[model samples]
Target: MKIIYSLFVWIIFGLMTAFLTVCGMPFVIIGKNPFFMLARLWSKISSKLFLVRYEVEGLEKIEPDKNYVFMGNHQSYVDIFSMISIIDKDFLFMAKRELFSIPFFGYAIKHMGLIPIDRGESRESLKSLFDAAKKIQEGYSVLLFPEGTRSEDGVMLPFKRGAFTLAVRTGQQIIPFVIDGSYKVMKKGAFIINPFRKVRIRFLDPVSPEGVKDREMLDIIRARMEDAQKELGSIGAGK
Candidate 1:
């Protein structure tokens, strides 16, 4: 029964994505942003289909009018959908270059101002981060996974420095968010979606980059996330 339900969810998700992509093209053509609208719609639909419940905390700490560099730990693909469903802000994703190569979806994200990083190439990756900094200057927030990829074992990985560098260079405040229980819903390298899972998202106090070195900023965010993970009692917390 779970297998059948999972299959049904995927089918619906794919169809919805295709439909929304086509619908968003008009806005993209006219140079108006459609990501926030379509992304929220997609996320709301997914929550219903997947039976995933979200418990978000610390929204009061977020100022809607201010742009930030939002960094978080990655565990599953569900993390992306979950954020889009809850965070009420206009933010762009700094995704991998490969994701931007997908046919229709790629075209939509590219035109919607999403930054793609070629992680395999240092120069290109740096260039992409600089471009993301420009987007931040334009009053658009950016979401990045400092782990750079999802953890296969539900354990949080070490943080990367690229996001911290961007924050310091742009003097943007960093909002470190922790996502718990997403790995149990749909872990990396898994296709089956587990329903009725409770995922907790907590936003930590914003770390200011002013007068802080990039490495110092990185340590601050990581220490906060580590403490938050332990507090949430997430899987692999002590490991």
Candidate 2:
């Protein structure tokens, strides 16, 4: 049953992505990538199809016109869509190169300015950071799962420095957020998607690197996310 449901969801995603590619062509021809705009649309459709109930807090703290490197704790594959559904901003995603292998989903993300990182190779990973820095200068925010990968137990993992580095280097602020209940929706190593899962997205206060170093900002932001998760009682599902 899970496999069938997964296939149906993937098929729908592929068709929608193909259509979005064509629909976004005008924006592409006009010197803008349509993937950014379509990401929100795709996220909305996916959440509804999967029976995900989305909730959010702290968005009112975000300032208008300010680009931020939004760091999220990955709890499940569901985190990506849930984050997009809550964030009301135009941003690009920095994801692994493997995700681009998906049929239409990969094709669309690659064109929408998704920065693919070869996580194992430092040299290639640094290049992705450089690309993200350039995008930051161009007035676009980047969404990154700084924990590097999803947490199997829903406990906040130690964060990597990529998002923090890019944010500091490009003079952008780091906005930390947490996703709860996604592990129950579908945890790592689980193939079944939990229907009508209630996933919560809580935006933390933005941390600035003005007088602080990148390493310090990383620690600060990680602690902030950890605190938020605990406050929200967002421990692993089934706990």
Candidate 3:
């Protein structure tokens, strides 16, 4: 049953991606924000198809008009869908370079202004971060997974320095968010997608980069995210 369900979900996802890509590319080429519109629709539909219930908190902490550097822990691929479904801000993801090589999907994201980071090469990665900083300077918010990749275990990985550096360079507030239960929803390397799971996302208070060093800002954000993860874990446990 799980295998069949997973196949169904993937088939639907592929079809949706192809359809959206074809429809969205023209708008993107003509200078429209179709990525956000189509992406949010995709995320919402995908969440329902997977039966993943989201319990999102701390949206009130965000100022709708202000641009921010949104950082989150990496747990599962579902984390992207979950964030897109809930975060109402106009934000672009600083995605890995490989994603941009993915045929139709790649073309759409690239034309729509998603920043691609080459994780393997230090110089290339630094260049990508600077590019993202420039985008933030243009009043666009950005989402980054500071852990660099999804966690193999449920535990949060140590964050890399690039996100903090970009935040400091752009002088944008870092909104640290933590995801609890996505690991169980779809663990890394798992073939089956677990359905009817509850995922909690809590956005912590924004940390300022003004008057702070990149390393200092990284530590501050990591501590807050860790604490928030623990709190969410306890809450989930009590349920």
Best by lDDT: 1
Residue 162 lDDT, candidate 2, scale 0-100:
72
lDDT of 1 at 132: 95
- State the displacement of the C-alpha of residue 96, model 2, in Å, after optimal TM-score superposition: 0.6
Q: Candidate 1, overall lDDT?
A: 0.87
Poorly placed runs, candidate 1 (over 4 Å):
237-239
Scored by TM-score, the top model is 1
Q: What is the C-alpha RMSD of each candidate to the true structure, in Å?
A: 1.4, 2.7, 2.9
The per-residue C-alpha lDDT of model 2 at residue 95 equals 88
lDDT per residue as tens, model 3, 145-210: 999998866687778988888999888998999889898889898879999999988998888899
lDDT, residue 33, model 2: 74
lDDT of 1 at 16: 86
lDDT of 1 by residue, 1-239 (tens): 87898899989988888899899888877978786688789888988888998888999889988888999999999998888888898789998899888877787678768899998999999999989999999899999999999987668887788889999999989999999988889889888888999999999998889999999998888888989988888765422
- Which is the winner by lDDT between candidate 2 and candidate 3? 3
Structural similarity to truth (TM-score) of each candidate: 0.95, 0.90, 0.95
Order of models, best TM-score first: 1, 3, 2
Candidate ranking (lDDT, best to worst): 1, 3, 2
In the predicted model 1, the residue pairs found to clash are none
